[model samples]
Target: MPKLNIFVGTMYGGALDVAEQVKPLFEQAGFDVTIFEQPMLEDLIQHKTDVALFCVSTTGSGDFPGNFVPFVRAFHEQGPALSELRYGLIALGDSSYGETFCGAGRALDALLEDHGATRLGERLEIDAMETFMADDEAVPWVEQWIDSQQLKAA
Candidate 1:
């Protein structure tokens, strides 16, 4: 089975909830899914993750959540090459924040790309001002993502 790591970054649990909501979907699609509430760079390297999903919520002034800060710092400092990694991103933020909306997710996307990771599809950006539940948007997107990637049970 293909292994999939879901990295979650949240301040008020929205991103975590989104991750939980989508876990079973990935499993149903034949992916061995793991959700990391507090992600670490070592988790990626040690587990040899090839495919991943990032569910992150932008905090104050577009800052990363406290739990996610360490992973971001480690990734930036260590600068591991991720040419073999494929990823999808879900960014939660209120659009009212303007340019800073989903800032953390956008930054992470760029960072991952810079490190040679391939993005499987377009990033999902959930606007808090419009969606009451992020999963509503995330679930459909994930389903499509799985289909687009042609993921099947091993």
Candidate 2:
């Protein structure tokens, strides 16, 4: 089975809830899914993950959630080339924040690309002001993402 790492960056647990809710979808598609509440850069590099899904909520002034700060810092400080990494992102934020909405996820998307990681599909940005449940949008997106990537259980 292809290994999938779901790295969650949540402020009030909304993002984590989305990750948990969507995990089984990937599992049913034959992926070995693991959700990391407090993700570390080493988790990505050490595991040789086949794919990664980042479910992050934007916090204070468009910043990363506290739990995800260290991982971002480590990636900035000692991250290596990730030309082989393929990933997806689900950004949860309230659009009321204006320009900073979904900032963390957008920034992470760029950071991953900067290191040569390939994003498999367009990033999903779930606006809290618009969606009552992040997982509602996330579930269908994951289903499409899986199909678009031509992924199947190995």
Candidate 3:
């Protein structure tokens, strides 16, 4: 019954919706959960959180939407400083954008990985242009991640 500190970042609300949905499920599973709206990468660097789940959307021209800029920069600049972090992530985008679909999600995952954060699960990519509910895929992905962590602990 340890706590899972969930860090969620969103743009245009889709990522937030996903985070909110996934959170209740985690809470129901006997895990104490603390949810935070991470607007910048600095939020990640500043907090000593366990099991961060980044939910982000790509903005114009492969950019992170306005709320996510600080987070992306912090990850890029000082991600390596977090030598003991563990993380999971969900990225939301439209393939229709062509030039830079899911770019923010990709960058965030890479930055976190470069810093020694163990990815608790696969990077869940949601292409809105292709599906109606990308977040639905996260259900199984997160359950598997949680189980994996338990096995590792034993």
What C-alpha lDDT, on a 0 to 100 scale, does residue 144 get in candidate 3? Answer: 76
The lowest-lDDT stretch of 10 consecutive residues in candidate 1 is 42-51
lDDT per model vs. reference: 0.93, 0.94, 0.72
Worst 10 residues of 2 by lDDT: 145-154
For model 1, the stretches where C-alpha displacement exceeds 4 angstroms are: none
Better of 2 and 3 by TM-score: 2
User: What is the lDDT for 151 in model 1?
Assistant: 69
Write down the RMSD of all candidates, one decimal each: 0.9, 0.8, 2.7
Please give the lDDT score at residue 17 for candidate 1.
97
lDDT of 2 by residue, 1-154 (tens): 7899999999999999999999999999999999999999998888867899999999988999999999999999996899999999999998999999999999999999999999998999999999999999999999999999887674
Off by over 4 Å in 3: 38-42, 77-80, 151-154
Which pairs, if any, clash in model 3?
40-70, 40-71, 41-70, 41-71
lDDT of 1: 0.93
Candidate 3 lDDT over residue span 47-150, tens digit each: 56656677788888777877777666665666456667777888888999996898888887887777777887678888888778866777777777667766
User: Pairs clashing in candidate 1?
Assistant: none
For model 2, what is the alpha-carbon lDDT of residue 9? 97
